[model samples]
Target: MSPKNLSALNKTHKLLLNKLKDKRTRQIYNKFEKYLNINENFAVAVSGGPDSLALSFLAKIYSIKNLLNVKYFIIDHKLRNNSTLEAKNVQKQLKKFSINLNILKWNGIKPKKNIQSIARDKRYELLLNETKKFKIKNILLGHHLDDLFENFFIRILRGSGLNGLISLDKKTQNNNINIIRPLLNFEKKDLTYISKFIFGFFVEDPSNEDDKFKRVKIRSFLKKLETEGLDKKKFLLTINNLKFSNETIKFYTKKNLLENTYFSEKKKLIILKESFFHHSAEVIFRSFTDVIKIVGKKYYPVRGKKIDSIIQLINNKSYFKVTLGGCVIKKVNQTVIVSKE
Candidate 1:
């Protein structure tokens, strides 16, 4: 073999080995690549942050080796004063790597209470719209290990059970689109390293540092705990255990859904038998909430006095109805009919 050919083969071998060495990266890439099932076309969501930027670079490299087609998206929320300039910078960086890019402008009204959440919803909407237009089935995100930890804490504080603590799935479907987070296994710090080393890329969002946001506050709290020599690994382990338990509960819940839930064009209802209701009040509440979710109504579990009230309504003999979080729960004829109010 020619020396140049041998050198090229060696490089290819090294690349393949590197992909296998990291379990998280390997798992995400494999799952996404298979889920996408496309040889040469996909859309990547890049905000030029350390996490997104690193994932973009990896996707670019992977595309070249695997004969995949890649397009990059940068959603300019226009909330920040310098958002346009930042988008331009990101475009320039992506161009240097020969990646095709699009900069989407957000012109919709922003939410009043939680600007971050509004921006996120808009961002995904824009990305999914573009992906659908481009006939791309796979959409990539930049969530990492630190994000999982932060979400775990946020859900815990919000009084969430197993589903919330399980955090996000490596791959999930949204509106017939496959959302994949390839960086879920990597830590934010590792992404930072990759960004600096490979692309000389870094992004600063002022909102991330602001203490007003719940996520920001939780991040700061976690950092303080780290400083205090708290075992983050053990904490995360506990969360993982809870997640596993939650998965088991979810399995049985799905079984119950198959057995008891009924869906129609106008409304969906779950028939909570006395046996199922007596399992665990927490599980029963979650099962009810899940039914509401399927019916396209957003419902959060009521707490304290509200929870007591819900329990009373469930146990009452006569018919009763109460509105909670845009959902109406009615008890009639030994069945609780949960629907949108």
Candidate 2:
């Protein structure tokens, strides 16, 4: 690169950093950085996409300014023919920024169903392996506001419960490794602007435009909604309100769990006695959902019909079992039991 071009790039980088040092970005970064602790050594998952690329750039700046150690990881699922080339390009870009990069490749057999989900699981597995090998505790992702909104709508469309509508958390613990999202408050458009103006980075994945993907369909639907005068700002405000409300409900739900539920560790069974059922059906339903979540099953709010069926089984003369999402709910003498079967 020419000296003049390098100087221009540096000027652009400074401008982009200053642009991101605003109220929203600062608030989000503070929450995220505190969770991941920008002062400590960490690893970032970079997929060479705009979101992750922006995160990588910001992480690099933060690490240098704070005298912290930060590493970059790119997982090659190797599902597509060009995955290797994409991974190599990501490594090349990180090298330009003087960031340490590691590429983890999946060389094993692929699963048969839902390749997207399978690839995501494999990607995280590779990340977990890296964290364990390097003894790194924090992992940063590039999930942005758009992603959260999309997730919220997706869950809603799928009849998900409050937990699903909660969308991506700012911080979570996965297998003892801390996962943090620093860009959740920033819009995808803002990240695109930063990537173009500062880093001169761009990525195009053909799969994103493929209409066969559920996410692509959702994106198109949301875009149409936007054109019909549905403001994303207002939608996000609704999500924020829903998130706060869900937290309050979860607080009570947790209390109910402590007071009403019993777990047989030896049998891996959870029991809810008749005394617990004396409360409102809403509470009972939420408690049931919570139990399912505790056992690592995805929770969807039970419809009135399903809830009625459960109530019938609970009140019946004969033992019966109801199953959903790999969770089994059984009626056992004066009590309702839930367990993984």
Best-performing candidate as measured by TM-score = 1
TM-score, each model?
0.74, 0.74
Candidate 1 residue-wise lDDT, 72-162, digit = tens: 9999999988999999998987665566679999986766787887688788878888998878888888888789889888988977656
- Top candidate by lDDT: 2
Clashes of each: 1, 0
- lDDT, candidates in the order shown: 0.72, 0.74
Predicted candidate 2 versus true structure: per-residue lDDT over 104-181, tens digit per residue: 889989887778777886777788778878889888988998899788878788777776777588876665687888
Q: Pairing residues by index, what is the TM-score of model 2?
A: 0.74
Pairs with steric clashes in candidate 1: 40-69
Q: Candidate 2's C-alpha lDDT?
A: 0.74
